[model samples]
Target chain A: MNFFRKQSLSRWLIHLWFIIFSVFCLIPLVYVISISFSTESDLAVDGYRLIPKTFTTFAYKYLLKSPDQLITGYTVSVTVTVLGTVLSLLITAMLAYVLSRKDFRGANKLSFFIFFTLLFNGGLVPWYILIKKYLFIGDSIFALILPYVIMPWHVLLMKGFLSEIPLALIESAKIDGAKEWRIFWQIVLPIAKPAMATVGLFIAFVYWNDWWLAMLYIDNEKLIPLQYMLYRIMNNIQYLSSSIRPGTVNIDISQFPNETARMAIAVMAAGPILVVFPFFQKYFVKGLTVGAVKE
Target chain B: MSYQTKIHNSQPLANMNVKKKNTFWREFLRHKGLLALAAPGLLFVLIFNYAPMLGLVLAFKDFNFRKGIWGSDWVGLDNFKFFFTSDAAWQVTRNTIFLNFIFILLTNVVAIAFALMLFELSRRAVKLFQTTLFFPYFLSWVVVSYVTYALLNPQMGVINQLLTQFGFHEVNWYMEAKYWPVILSLAYLWKNVGYSTLIFYTGLMSIDKSLYEAASIDGASKWQQVRSISIPLLSPLITLITLLQVGKIFYSDFGMFYFLTADSGALYATTDVIDTYVFRALRVSGDTSMATAIGLYQSLVGFVLVVTVNYIVRRFNKDNAIF
Candidate 1:
């Protein structure tokens, strides 16, 4: 009984530690959500709160008043994510299938070709220049999609996954007179579905969360994705707040519900991922574990 | 038995035929279908990856819009000279490696400790904790920036509000460079520690439970069991992750450094890293040549570090090496 009590006490202490850490992880997000729902006037008066002093959806209302940018952002983000994920998965899976084939004469050379990208690169400047000047991808939607389409790491991860499929299965398909493309499309892809889902979700997350490509290549407002839209809104707010010194010309920054609206925009932007994450968490964990354990 | 014999005979006969008539062209013709399937990806890397690699010659050239990458005259190391002599070079490099080192050390320790705690929990509790902790990983840095802003925003921020409630002066968090190393480290941990902890926990779960059972039977305490069994078994993962991070010491999460700081010039004292510096030089300052040279320097050094680390890892445990 005494030993049980001691063990339980240690377990409770561990539980307590995790609860506190979990709260620490979650509070900032909750605070942001709380502040977003708070009235701007209340925010200014009460500072900020874990729960709002007075709840209002005024920030969201304000955002809806000019919905064009938000709509465009959603469209671009959705388009890039869907188009990019499917195309990326297709190329990545196809390449990985070829690489996984033991009889493919060029598999070693091709694997090295893909793997070397992990080691060295031309760095950002040359890549940016090539994309911007040489490729003429400026302000185009392809600018957003193409740069991330063939992430070498994802390729390698998919290769690792595909390599585990029994070679006999593929060989039997070949003996049945299926062409390589037909075999890959029918046999390899079906076997690799779980991996595709994992890699696909990862690629989707990359496209959905990307602002880097937009920041570099996008000058067109229509081409800006949701994350970059949030970024711009945040930037404008920061500019307003910083520019308003004690002695400045006193632009009425208060007219723009900057504080609450920024949060509202963030909640709207990240809302979908949060909703879908629970369902997808298992696959993500499986993917990460497979990658890590292979080492 | 007959099926196995037929497969064996056919495989050797196929190999013999290939060995008898194999030329590069014939092999190419034979695998054309597979090669056809590989074409799109091959073309993509050749264009997007290899082309840029060849374009690293921009590091040596004085870039002019009228004169394309190959058309430009070679400045012959002037770009590199200018970069090496700059005050920003040493500062950014030091900050990059130093901050990365600190982040890696702090995050891994916290994650390992957390993973051990999670390993001791009931399944339901572990699931609950993981779900909550992993929530932050789904958020982008831009959203995370807002979260940080909510806490650290000068006037109406949560921290400032709490400070005032505690009878203290409100901190101007953005302007203060001194606090950023700790602040950035915390932000990094908040966004990332969950993922690392998950990785470690996955590793811990894979550890044979029988070892712990045996250790307990041998009169070991829980702490002893953990120290002797859990950590020793987990060291390979710890080493692999730490070594991989060391290989990336030259890089920084540009989003975190850029967005979280809101690109405040004052905070660059502690926060400027090679990636951020290279970005600013390319976009903010329009010093393309210098940026290219610095980027090339970073790539070369980073490549060497990764190769050396991977080689060492391979020497110790060939299976665990990234290559």
Candidate 2:
């Protein structure tokens, strides 16, 4: 819409600005992926080279020496992401559907009740104590799943989507003698597919990127998630060398995947998520567009 | 709703209006299935969210587990006093507010500028740039910490190597506290700019295209159009976003600060915020009480800030107020 001449100085300057910033934004990923493939000797010799001087699989090989931790971490993360996304989507959609109903007398009250949670909160220690002591879900997988399942912001966004579906459709379905459950499953759910895909990706990403819950709640080695494991290793390399899983033989510090292996592990931890990014790119933008629309 | 039963029965409105008193009850029974479906989620929020607002009382107590939450001795204002009186109090408060202020201002300007820039590009170029820019937002901070380490590592980091090539001595980025403020701000901008860019872009897209055409016909230059139309129209949404940001002034992005710094105590002077401080109090010092106290302080101030800003917005422009 900036209808300046094709060869204008501002056009070239803006293009240069965006091109530079895009590269700057990508450098973290480029550097990490590059170092992950670099030979340990080359990394030590060159010190964070942009492209690997001598590419090798040695870092990944050494990092996988104790395959149990990596496998368990992935297993925990994938399992939780799958289960958590489904549960969160169902609960959020149902609650939003109810709020979307113009006929439901409690809709306004319920909306305010849910939205109020976003403003005020019980401080972390109390919430922590609630889950850890009162609920007794401590060290269990439920600790990770329960806290995030009812995100109010997602509920509000889903309501916006549902509200856009013509009210007459729901009324017509009900007048045809369909049950509420049938109407929701057959009529509403299919119409709201785009919204579901967007929120599903959002919830899945939340479950994937979480390390805080695992750090706070679980002490069990079997339950450690990928991000927390990456965090421990990256925070201190010595932890990687020692028995990350107790009851296993302790490795000497010198043989640890001390440098290259650490970066390699970071790459592996983020591997599946990054590969899935392009697939969900459209849906993610749609979700943000939903927010912009509501505004 | 059962209030519409007369319509289904093909009866007159006079007949149904007499029985309107029972409408709510009958409607409740009629929609029992939907109500049942919504119960679990309602219960979940009740237990997790609203229930904890009561636990803010732990901020006043000694937090003895044996005594339990209700049974603990009341030590009113002691914890709050301790938080404000602590030596690290002012520094942490300043860091939290200052960092958040800078992020709010910087992300808005950069995101809006980038959004305007995206508007000037071809469709293919916009898509390509959008993906690359959004990539970092998906990465976990733990991975990013290693990325930061690669760039800032004392001996073999890319920055040091670049310095050496320029005929200057290498600078140790981690040990120094001064460099972290700039680095952390840059990191925050990198992770968030893509999301904000999308928002601003959507806002720009929603504007009627014919307006720009009409402006050009009237001999309005590009800058004039942007200043008169784009900035004026977008300012309300921008202010709303800025107010939402101001609400979180007392909070910090824990992962960004904790992970990217690699938990180097040397840099804590410039980097630590209230959230990290509370986390350290909980983990390292094993003082849950102190942690809860600081949390209550942060939440109270934040809650007040959000409500007050929202009230001000509502008074002026009812359409833009969040609540």
Candidate 3:
């Protein structure tokens, strides 16, 4: 009877600990969300209160006022993310399929070629110079998409996933006089949908979150992606004024809602993905489990 | 007459065979669309990843803008010489190694604890805990900086508010260098422990359940079962993650160090690592050659460390080594 009581006591303690930890993880996000909705003056005075005394969407309204630039940045971010993810998934799947095939003569060599990039990289300066001088992808949308298209890690994930597909499926399709492309498109891709979604979501996340390429190769105002724009806004308050001029009057830098604007930008950048997260959550977890084991 | 002529014209038949071989070449040419699919990615890597590798020679040269990279004056070993002689070099290198060591050690320990706790929980509770914990990993450092600001801001921060309410003096966290190492490590663990916990948890799940049952039946305590069965089985994963981190120990997470500190001069002593140091030196001074020297230094050290660690791991357990 005493042992049963101790077990129940321990179980309660564990449950309490889990709840506390979960709250710890969530409070910062709650603070950000709350502060975003709070009046700027209220946040400045109160310092990120859990419950805002006065709630207002003034910060978001101020942001949405300059709808043109925000819309353009959004469109740019979405286009690159969508186009980059699709191209990357198709190419990665095809390459992975070829590499996963047992009869492919050069599969091992190709796999090694892809794998070697993960180990050694020619550090930042040279990479910067190459993008600027040789590729000349500077100040273009291609600057974002081209440099990050084929991540070796994702390719390896696809290869691992493709290896799990039944060989009989491929054999039967080949026996029906189906070419390699048709067999891959018709049979393999449908079976690999979960893996594709997993890898695609990751690739999309990378493209969406990318500001490194813009930081390095892009300097033009029009070419800046959403994250980079957000970064610029956070780093330089002057950018907010210059980019989002309401009229001929120069807006006071002090009056430009800095703190709440930062939170609002954070929401705009990550909020869409977070909303879509639950649907892809299962596949993501599975992918992470497999990928983390190997890495 | 035609039939007899056809039988006699064996040379024409040989030409026809050669023509068939030529048609094979033509077929390959006609399928250029297949190869075109790979073109954009191939071109990108070649230009961005591979071509930059050739510019590594700048580390060996006295880089001059007028002469360009290839035309730069050859000053072999001087770039390396300047780097080795500098006092900041050792400080940055030491800071990088020490910080990474603490991160890897603490992150793994905390993650393992969380993973064990998580595994012991009910299925529904585990999912809830995971989603909550893992949410931070997706947030950018820029956003995390804001969160940190909210916690540690001098005047209106939650901590300060609580301290004042408790009759304690409010501390200026941003101005203090001594408090930053601990603060940064805690922040690092908070953001990353979820990832490591998930990794360790998945590894735990794959462990055969019978091992635990057998140990329990043999009068082993929960602790003993964990020690005897769990740790030993999870060693490979633990080693792999540790060694992989060890490889990049020379490179700090640039975003964390830069953004979290908010480029405060007061915190540079504790916060500056090789990457941040290089960024400051290059951006402030515009010394292209010196930046290249630092880059080369980091890459060389990182490469050597990875190789050495892999060798050590392979010595103990062949299957577990990264290579």
- In terms of DockQ, the best-performing candidate is 1
Candidate 1 backbone collisions, by pair: none
Evaluation by lDDT, superior candidate among 1 and 3: 1
Error of 2 at B254 (Å): 0.9
Per-residue lDDT tens digits for candidate 2, residues A45-152, read: 677788899888888888787899999999999989999999999999998898888888867778888877766677678888888888989999998788999998
lDDT by residue (tens digit), candidate 1, A94-154:
8877887777666877888987776788999999999999998878999999988888878
Query: Between candidates 2 and 3, which one is better according to lDDT?
Result: 2
For candidate 1, what is the TM-score?
A: 0.89
lDDT of 1 by residue, B154-233 (tens): 76789998999999998888888999999999999888888889878877887889999999999999899999999878
Among all windows of 10 consecutive residues in model 1 chain B, the one with the lowest summed lDDT is B16-25
Candidate 1, position A45, lDDT: 72
Worst 10 residues of 1 chain A by lDDT: A286-295
Q: Report the C-alpha lDDT of model 2 over B203-318, residue by residue, as the tens digit.
A: 67667889999998998878888888887767666766677678778888899988888777778888999989999987888777778889888888898999999899889888
lDDT (10s digit) by residue, model 3, range A1-295: 9867876777678789978988987787777777778787776666668877798887788889887778877888899989999888888878777667655444565667676565566777777666666566777888888778888778877787777777888889888988777887899898888889878887887788777677777777777778777766666753454466445673444365567777777778878778866677676545554433242
True contacts kept of each: 0.73, 0.66, 0.37
lDDT of 3 by residue, B1-323 (tens): 45534744766765676666655655545534333433554555566566777888988888776677798998888887887798878878878888888999999999988888777777777777887777777666766777787688676667788898899998878678888889889889888988789878877887899999988889887778888998888888888778778878888888789778876667877888988887776567777777788888888878788889999889989878876
In DockQ, how does model 1 score against the reference complex? 0.57
Query: Largest lDDT belongs to which candidate?
Result: 1
